[model samples]
Target: MDTPSSSPYGTYVIAVRGFVAPFEIGVYAHEHGRRQRLRIDLRLTVRRTAPRFTDDVATVLSYEGLVAALETLSEGPHIQLLESLADRIGDLCLSDPRVVEAEVSIEKPHVFPQIDAAGVTIAYRR
Candidate 1:
C-alpha cells in the first residue's frame, strides 16, 4: 500500500486545445485574409492534491477560466505577430495559483502567401 507521503510523482497537466480566434495578422495589404484564425493550445502544470483529495472542481484551476481569458484577449486589436499572442497566453495561464508552468502555441493556418500552413509556438514557466 502506498501512503500519500510515498505516492508516485504528483502533478497535473491540463491541456486546452483548438481555440480559434480571428485576427488581422499580416505585413502587407494584399497579404490580409478575411480573418486569420489562431488556434491556441495550452498545457498547464498544476498541483495534484486538490482534485485528488477533495474531488472538487473549484479547488483546482478551471479550464473554462483559462479559455475565457484567452477568448477575451483574442477579441482585442489585431496582433501583428503570433509570438506576441503566444506570450500573452502563456502569461495568462501562469497567472493562476495552480499553474506552475505553461506551453502556448498560436497557429495561423492558410496565412502564408504560398505555404499550406504557417505559424508560431512559444513556451513559458513560473
Candidate 2:
C-alpha cells in the first residue's frame, strides 16, 4: 500500500473538491446581510518519510481535519475577497508539518447571472 509518508514523489496528495456552502462574503454594498453560495477546492501535497501499515488515525492526515479547519475559518469574520480567503486557507493547510504544499480555490457561484462562477486559486509551499 502507498502510505501518505512514502510516495513515489516523496509526497502524496489529498484533495477536497466542490465543497459548496453559503457564507457571508463580498465587498459589494448589496452583498452584505445575506449569505452567498461559495465553493472551496483544496489540494494538499504532504511529505512522507516511509510507508507503514498502521491502524492509528494519527499516523496519517485526515480529510475531516481539513474540512474542520475550513469550517473554522468560515465561521469567523466575513471575508471580503476570494483571494484573501484562498490565501488564508493555504496558510491553514501549511500549518501541518507534514504538508509541504497547498492549492486553494474559492469561488462565488452567484456573482453574476451570466457567469457560472467567480473565484480565485492560490498555491502555497513550505
Candidate 3:
C-alpha cells in the first residue's frame, strides 16, 4: 500500500476507508501521553469511462498504494487537529493525476465523555 498517487478516472470517484490507526492527534496533555484510535475516510473523485473501457490498471488509482501512503502518515508525529490532518490527506489525494477532488474525514470516537461520538472532517478540491 505504499506508492505515489495515480488516477485512472475519466470521470469516477472512489470511497475508501482505512480503519483505526492509533495516533497522538490532539492538543490536550492527556491526549499526547498515549495514542488514540483514529478512522480515516476518503472520497476520491475521478473519471469513470477512460480506464474502465481501456482495461488498463494504470489508467486508474491504486487503492492499495493510497492506503499504504496514508498509513505512513499516521505513523509519524502527532498532529494537533483533525483539520490539519484532513488537509494533508486531501493534498495527498490530489497527488494522483486522475483525481479532480477529494474529501477527507478523520474521526476520533468518544472524544467527549458525555457525547456518543465526535471528530473532524475536511474537504479539498483541485
Q: Quick one: best lDDT, which candidate? A: 2
Looking at candidate 1, the ten consecutive residues that score lowest on lDDT are 2-11
For all candidates in order, the CA lDDT equals: 0.72, 0.82, 0.76
> Which 10-residue window in model 2 sums to the lowest lDDT?
2-11
Of models 1 and 2, which has the larger TM-score?
Answer: 2
lDDT of 1 at 84: 79
> What's the C-alpha lDDT at position 3 in model 1?
40
Assess the local accuracy of residue 30 in candidate 3 as a C-alpha lDDT between 0 and 100.
Answer: 83
User: How well does model 2 score by local distance difference test?
Assistant: 0.82
Top candidate on TM-score is 2
For candidate 3, lDDT tens digit of each residue in 20-45? 68877899998886888888888888
Per-model TM against the reference: 0.79, 0.86, 0.83
Candidates by lDDT, descending order: 2, 3, 1
Give the TM-score (vs. native) of candidate 3.
Answer: 0.83
